[model samples]
Target: MQAYQVAELTPGLGADERREFRDRALSSARNPSQFTQLREIEGYGEARLSLIERYLLQGTPDASALAAREAVALSAQASQYAKAMEGRYVAALLLMRRVLLGTALVTGLLSVTSALRALLLWRSEMDRRARREARQREALSLASHELRRPLQSLLLASDLLRHAETQEQRTHLLALIEDGAAQLASRADLTRLNDLYLDVTLRPRAQDLRPLLERFAAPRVELSLPLEPLVWPVDGDRLRQIVENLVENALKYTDGPVEVALREVGSQPEVTVRDHGSGLSDTLHGQVFLPYDQGPRGLRGGQGLGLPLVRRYARAHGGDVTLAAAPGGGLQATVRLGQPAGTRAETQAAGGAGLLQARSDAG
Candidate 1:
């Protein structure tokens, strides 16, 4: 009966079907001995098993192991990517926190600096206002003192002229009255007041020099000639004021004679007022030219504006005024003005005239 059953099974399966069954058994086995056991099965032929090992199992072990290892490596790489994404998110959060803090610190510093700048500006403005007020007060005080002297002189002269007796004495009194009236008239002239302020404050303009000097020169003060006329572009009115002020100052401060000399120095013409008064102190020399600056302590009744005005006028003319100890023991003030724009012949002529005047004054 067993032999009959085997023959029936063997006869039912074809050769190709038998070979496919052997290959499946070999592929499913975990070890070489498991394939050997499958080969010993009753219907499995040794020849079919040998064909499976040669065609299917041969050269396939290494390929199968490599495929399994690649799957495991892919899983590990996915796990590492997940961890890296988490780390990057944490780092981004830390950077964002630092940026926010830095912005706040910078904003606070800027606010403090702006406040300090505003405080400094306010303090500076307050200081300027205080200084301006002080200057105005000083100016008013000096103007009042100056006005008082001239008013008193006019009143005294008027009173004297009213009571004169003899004709000769009346004539002399009339002359004094005329002098006082002229002085009063000068004080009343608004133009003179404007000029007085301008001389010390404003810039000078080009003007004729000869007529300007002539207008202010005292009638008693004589001038010499250089045989040729000279011309210059200068601040005429300011120059006149400076000359008049210096001459008047010389007459007021000293008992000896005074002289004014004009000469040409290269392309510039210079006016020098020399007086036999006590010279300025070496220590106070530079200070004398500043506005509101006073001379020596002993020089009374002077408001200390004369030399400063002269300096301002000189500067306006693009020139300067200097003080020196004169050879005759007095003050020598030299005011230099640049030569005017004109023909060479005209400039020479003007220079000659200035030279003549200088010689006349020197004599």
Candidate 2:
């Protein structure tokens, strides 16, 4: 059943009572029975009710025109609010899209970079392993080659000694045995020398360089050691090895008297071994330190490990060994030992020269 829907218009109604009456009318708009009952109220004349009646029910041209204008303006205002909410939704969606795209891009880049880094590291490790294997093979080959001649000589000497005819023959056979044994001893020394180069824990201690030099020098060799004790950091056994190698190399190759000198150069302690025979050409000087590389002057049968070992030992001490043409002729071998602090950094730049290559790169 239809009910009148006009808001109660009472002359004695308070503001609160009027608001409550209007709310009741709006709440019942879906039910025509409520509006039908309210419309039949005798003298109700609320403005909202008049607009509704004129626009919807009465259908008078002038009243409808007024109601239509009011309804159109209110609809436009409501549409503006709805459009604002729709714009906010669109903006929020675009922002979310941008965030998702950026996250995806960053994640992709990071993944690619990580994969690339891992591949590069793996390749480097593989290359290092290959080089190490190659070096090991070369060392074995060198060892076999070195040991072969001596081994043959020892075997021959043993056979001859067993069937010796006289004391002289036996003595000669024994000398051959001694030479073979010496060759084997030299091979063992070479192995020890390699170990010395690779040893990182070889600590240098303060030592007097003058006496060390003099001890290795023969009486015939001229010594120009510093009058003031050239005290420097050195490993005693290694220093002796360096001195003996240099002195021996000098005397072995040259006809003239060998000169041994020790002096301080900057923070480094320098030892110079000079001989007065024809020196090597410029090109040979650089290669003289390379393993198994003997210069043009060194054509005679000799294992070419001496200069290389000297260089390796000197470098291991955080210093360097250099060979140059001496003034007035012959070759000069100079050895420099670094201060302890400088050695740590040199060990970094040594370029895969010993066991330190792995440890330094890892650091």
lDDT of 2 by residue, 299-354 (tens): 35656766776776687777888888998889899998875434455545654263
Poorly placed runs, candidate 1 (over 4 Å): 1-122, 134-207, 216-227, 339-363
Cα lDDT, all candidates: 0.59, 0.65
Deviation (Å) of 271 in candidate 1: 0.7
Q: Candidate 1 residues 98-151, lDDT tens each?
A: 755655655665665576588789999999999877755544543443445447
Candidate 2 positional error at 176, Å:
24
